[model samples]
Target chain A: MSTPENWTPQERQLHDALHRSAERVQPGPDGLARIRRRTAVVPMWRRPVVLGLAGATALAAAVIVGGVIALNDGDDDAPVASQTSTSPAPSPSDTTAQTAPPTTPPAETTPPAQSLTVPVYYVADSGDGLRLVREFHAIETSLTPIAAAVNEMLTAPPADPDYRSLWAPGVEVTAADLADGAIVVDLSAPPTAGEDPDLAAQQLVYTATAAAASAGQDGSLPVRITVGGQDPSEPIGRTDPLEVRQLVQLNDPAEGATLPSPVTVTGEAAVYEANVLWELRRDGEVVDSGNTTAEECCTFSPFSLELDLEPGAYQIVVSESDESGGEGRPPMSDSRTFTVE
Target chain B: MVQDRTGSEADDAITDLYAAHYVRLVRLATLLLGNEAVAEEVVQDAFVALHSRWRRLREPAAAVAYLRTSVVHGSRSVQRRRGVAARHPDEPPGHAPSAEQVAVGGAAADAVVEALRGLPHRQREALVLRYYGGLSEAEIASAMKISNGAVKSHASRGLAGLREAMADWS
Candidate 1:
């Protein structure tokens, strides 16, 4: 390699070409000139403080654009599902909406809030076009335990596994909402053995709350959860067949729940399952039994039944029909008494 | 306010630096970038960055080196954008210019760009500083974060390759 000292004709000509190219460049526009002038006028130290805010604005825009693009490009077909927002409220048509037909006796209760308070709503698909619904708050993203537990469920195959984990392990969960008032969570039970079942259950709670919170309700999450057709535990109230009573608005004067709106039941029950027995009972005697079928699987059976009745301490009994045409030994439901004038 | 210096004094210094170095830096950037408009934008961006960090800039003496390095990095960005340019760092074989080719005018510039763009990002920066900005090999090496030997070798190889590809441009 010849040095610059060699005076090669080509080397010198290359140098000349560079100069010609350099000559065509214009100075930066007015904004830059203004920056020049400001830097010219301000004390050197103050320039940073001023520029810092300005720089932040530019950085904020760049970050918004970049982060959006990064998030968008992270997955081609689907954007990152924000683990936060009420994960897609199970619309009215979700197929896993098979709840027992509601036979809950509607007790004279407080009017429902103008808006329903939901902590979380997790809607997922059962690969065979069947959708499963569950909800809760504060789902964890520590990810490992959930992953292992899910793997265990897959391998163990309880009776028959309803949902094959479609999501892979280690995929980052994206968050969307922050309303932790009432959570509808999907299961976090990993398929692996020796997994902390408590943590897994809490994962369900955490995700539901986080999603509900992200969706914008206050953090006091009253949560409900469902796996397959069975309630995770026992009913919040005593009712047959419809055993998942986490959703029952337990109108306990003792519990201090004052409804600003009419009380309504929102969930899924099978058509063949005992039709929803929306009852009206005053001190245990049946006042009115408003009945409706859940009509679909994994759907939101929002029974907005209006019973014109006088009130004083009434119990609402909502129950489900089993495959054997009977209510679950203990039904899924709640009872609340109110003074409706 | 920069505590070390008072208001107007610091202002004058900043103004003087901008006035003196702005155009030359743009030209230097232009040489590496091969696009005049882009060079100016790169220079403006570098200056803005400098302004933001002006307080932490302890030594005015190193500002020129700071500016040159900024231009070099900016030129690399241009190369990334162009995609048509940047290639392997390997040197092309040297070729003598024919008598007919030596007569070409500014058309020779297009060939220069073609050859320089072919050089590695670092080698191109080294050559631009050495020949266009007239910086010494040591100065070029310091600005480029490379050793003097590396600068010498890169410049030599860059020139040799330019001789081959730009032989037709004269």
Candidate 2:
């Protein structure tokens, strides 16, 4: 493969350039730890040893299976129907034992319907400009996922104080459904298109599509907006995320999670040279500060860093470095507060 | 050969693969997705997936291939969901290329990377897996789930686009 005779100068140049560009990307040190945490949570049936153990003791297997089902039903009952249907009877003798435990508790504990974790989008002012930020809200309603999410986007106050809905208050989603590979959303009133009309429209598009996806519908479909029985215009589709999303967003260690040692911070950013700077603060005082680079420069890429610290409440603020030396708009930033126990 | 492998053995194999390929795979995904955070998540998900299916795929060679295929497919899903926004169309007007260009190995490299981002998804995947990943035509074909002939066509067409994009550099 290294034979020089077959290589063109352009290809060689590209190879060198690609390596130089890619060499800057360093995976976080906590990657294995993160993967281990995830793998540990995978269903026991997927592991051979666990399956072997389950095969040996039918009663024990039934109990374990029932326990897993009970736990899952507690969190979300919508998927349990399909799960029980597929794994109808792991053991013929214990079928009654297993099925009886899972079926009863849900009916007693849960209400008539299950609530969905809907991804709701809101507009936020960042150093870069106004951009869309997302928050997941557990919405309990009879409305479909699309309508429920759109309704929340219009009515609910953003959990984050800095974020807000672009749609006017009292606006409600009259109906929402997927048809012909497009999401059709009808609003009770014509929305007040804010200064950035495109972004305002995107707020609806992102929210509707995100909610639909949560319900197992295609998220990429364009959204057709109808207001007061009138079509606003052509259906609105997603804009390039880099252009529309805040330059820096802190995704993990969500706003106020309490964690053990070695807390890992992960987020996305599009900054000059892909550099993201972070400051760890407590009691409104800067405690620790450091900088890390994202995978790519001048484009949105992921960056992660891990910190080991003593237990207490702390805030981590991550931002882009000012490449313009204070000339351009201030480097965009995002932050979250969490307790380290 | 499909024995019930112990957890520690699986952990050791995963650790070895992680040490060897995690950074490179993440970089490959970053190139494909242009977002490192999402790229890392994609690669990490691939690893977790590999760990779950380890008994079925016990060989290191097969594992590496699985990781590559997983990363490729993962990146494709992200791109599909995010919807292809034209690259850098929103670079604030009057904003000059930052001084970081020198740090990334000069403007020519930056131009190449930028131009590479503009190509069609298949062509970009072909070129990246070929030149950057140093995979053979057959490997690229398998990773991309396309034919060797298709890989060749995408690579040639992608190179043409890069050459045209970087014409000033030449």
Tens-place lDDT digits, model 2, residues B49-168? 999899898999999999999999998887555422221122211123356745555567767878888899999999889888999898998999999999999999999999976666
**Best candidate according to TM-score:** 2
Candidate 2 displacement at residue B113 in angstroms: 63
Candidate 1 residue-wise lDDT, B1-170, digit = tens: 11112344444455556667877887787566655556655776666666666667745767667777777877777656642232112222112334443454444665676678778877788888887788877788877888999998888788777777777764
How does chain A of every candidate compare to the true chain A by TM-score?
Answer: 0.30, 0.61
Q: What 10-residue stretch in candidate 2 chain B is worst by lDDT? A: B86-95
lDDT of 2 by residue, A82-101 (tens): 34335431222231233322
Clashes per candidate (backbone, < 3 Å) = 102, 5
For candidate 1, what is the DockQ-based docking class? incorrect
Candidate 1 shows a clash count of 102
Off by more than 4 A, model 1: A1-6, A28-34, A37-341, B1-10, B77-104
Looking at model 1 chain B, report the run of 10 residues with the lowest lDDT sum: B86-95
Each model's DockQ score: 0.17, 0.20
Residue B82 displacement (Å), model 1:
11
